[model samples]
Target: MVQLDATTQEVLNRISEEFAQKGAYNLRQNGVALCHGDSEHIKIRKKEDKPGIDILIDGDTKGERVFIPVVVSVSGMTDLVYNDFYVADGADVTIVAGCGIHNSGCNESRHDGIHTFHVGENANVKYEEKHYGEGNGTGSRVLNPVTNIEVGRNSVFTMDTAQIKGVDSTVRETNVELAEGAKLYVLEKLMTDGEQKAESNIEVCLEGSGSSAQIVSRSVCKGHSLQTFHPKAVGRNKCHAHIQCDSIIMDQAHVGSIPEIQAEHVDAAIIHEAAIGRINDEQLLKLRTLGMTEAEAENVIIENFLS
Candidate 1:
């Protein structure tokens, strides 16, 4: 059994607390705190040529879960890692991953993570990731993440991502490609407060017959924060694709939503929608009438909006 430092454990609780338990996760704090595999069918190990890890899920496995989380607690530290996941054919699993940073110094703390997933034929995978930052310090908190996924024939991949905490700056990008009869679904939620800035870029390609994809994003901007979202989907065969981007703005905040869809074949179907607006007065008034303060009402709306 392995143990996590108090500070690191506290931060891990913000994202995937249950996986922080020993013998249940592959966790890295500042460096490799602990790394282990779930079973013979599942393996976790370092990348001999790189600074990250590789997760291998065996074929025909059913009803399994894996967690790999990272945390950074040192001020003035910048970390970069590349992780890869390989899911074998006919397997169904859920993967939980996230990064949390706790910095308390005069220098900036930043983390950049690149993840790539290969889903084999007929495999079904659900992936979730969250980002958080907390500290009382003069330094800034920053997180940038890049994800690439290749879904094989008849496979399905679903992704959920959220970042609603004290990050000062972030740029997130996701790219996906679907094979014959494959499907890709995504739901993204974000919140930016104070002077934080966030940018999201998503692109997907439905390149095989019967392949389909859908992407949706919801974000809230408060104070002087800024956020921008770009979602694009392309259909290259007898496939379907849709993209949607929506956001809420408040108190000197700014938001931009850009959605695009393209069809390259006569049988390809694609559509897109985008909207940005402020908090609805009617919604706020209703909450306030229930004896909640204006600020409290706004908070409630923001929380539900992101959810």
Candidate 2:
């Protein structure tokens, strides 16, 4: 692993300390690549024409993990990066990625990331990501991430993402395509407070027979925050897909969930579920009766809901 400064380590610790300790890892700061480490099964290389990297995972690689994390602490800085991944056939591995920002001046700090992944036949890939921001500056912390994934025949792709806390603004988008006998599952969690705003849009296309997919989202909004979610599933063959969106609203917060399904074949099966509401009064009362304040009760309910 490469040496890190205090600011970099602070942001890494907030996201995941184990990421820096991983054998295969890449760290990017400001507008440059800081350091990257490669393992026996994974190789990370900087892109020739872009401000990002290309990761190649060996075939049949098991029990291996890769970490790709970026941080922006300089105020008024805007960072954009494009990263790609190639996973060989029969490989089973996990990839961790996210961005952290801290602004200490009166200028906004923003990071935008575009990632594309290719999964080979019979491969299994699990990807995890988290976004976070913090500082006492008047500047806003902004993040926008776009992901594109292609799952090969008989392959499996699983994605889990979260917005932990302190992000001022964000727009998250994802697109996925699956081939024959492929499987996909995605779970996203988010929390916002104090005038924060977030929007998420995701679409999945099942283009081959026997393909299946499921997408689920959970979010919490508080203190004048606003959130919107759009999740869609498209079935072009004899496949099945499901989308679920759920949210909790509190203290003048606003939330909207729109789910869509499209079927192009007779044997296609698709479904969607959307629910947006606030904490239950009875649950809050019960918690309050247990010697908890209203704020504490609400926090507990929100935590459990997002969890």
Candidate 3:
């Protein structure tokens, strides 16, 4: 079995100590990874193959929290999977997950992911995710992600995702769940350029009275690429939901946002909003009139928007 580097080993050690202080936990070096907690049914596996990195998450844990670290580099083509990390009843847990790619080597890559969360009554969970890519290579990337959440009465679940740049990339997915007397919030962002494309399908269904859900999304597409965002909200009796998506386009780039709202009960209230547009040409002309070159004008806009 291959061992982790000194830096990774130190990180594992720190997490293990933290687990011990909470009592009734164990930590050990598994083949190619580290394991923590006395979790029997839960499993995290990482494998390296020609296509790229492969990860597997199985079952739920009874612990207070669960943590997993993933790193992958693909010079050719790759595909990956992320199973849902389950949260036990009346237990609070946090899942911090991130993904990065060696954009220079790989010609193409795709990420296939699914997250199933079981929120117990009166429990709370915090989930965060980050995705970024780099390299000058020309290829295509597809990210298909699905999140299934079941929130018990009076529980809370929050999910956030940040996606950086990619060329000729496409992302599509769905998020759905049932919340009773609880609350759910989702925040997502995407940035892209150069023939890139991203599509996301999001939906939230409220089944419990007094339950609420909010969805917020922002995106930027530049250099002839296309970006699309679709968000839907459905409310039942005495439930409420909100959905919104915003986007900016540049240099023949294209962006589209679709927001849908459905209220089945008269007691329910739902709202949906969407907006997409490109930078102002007259503003750039004004910059040029002020002695700034065309290139400089565009650069200024990018710096102001991204920085």
Top candidate, metric lDDT: 2
Tens-place lDDT digits, model 1, residues 115-229: 9999999999999998999999989999999999999999999999999898999999899999999999999999999999999999999988999998889899999999989
lDDT for residue 187 in candidate 3, whole number 0-100: 84
- Candidate 3 C-alpha lDDT tens digits along 1-307: 3445554344333323232312222222221233333345434433344211222222243334544433334456454554445455566666655444433443665555556676767767777666555545554555565667788788888888767655356565766666678899888877878767778788788888999998888777877887878788788768878887777777788888877788989989898877777666887999999999988997786556543
- State the TM-score for model 3: 0.73
lDDT of 2 by residue, 133-221 (tens): 99889999999999999999999999999997989999998999999999999999999999999999998999989999999999998
Ranking by lDDT: 2, 1, 3
RMSD (CA, Å), each prediction: 1.3, 1.2, 6.8
- In candidate 2, which residue ranges exceed 4 Å CA deviation? none
Off by over 4 Å in 1: 22-24
- What TM-score would every model get versus the actual structure? 0.97, 0.97, 0.73
Task: Name the candidate, 1 or 3, with the larger TM-score value.
Answer: 1
lDDT of each: 0.88, 0.91, 0.62
Candidate 1 at residue 208, lDDT? 89
Better of 1 and 2 by lDDT: 2
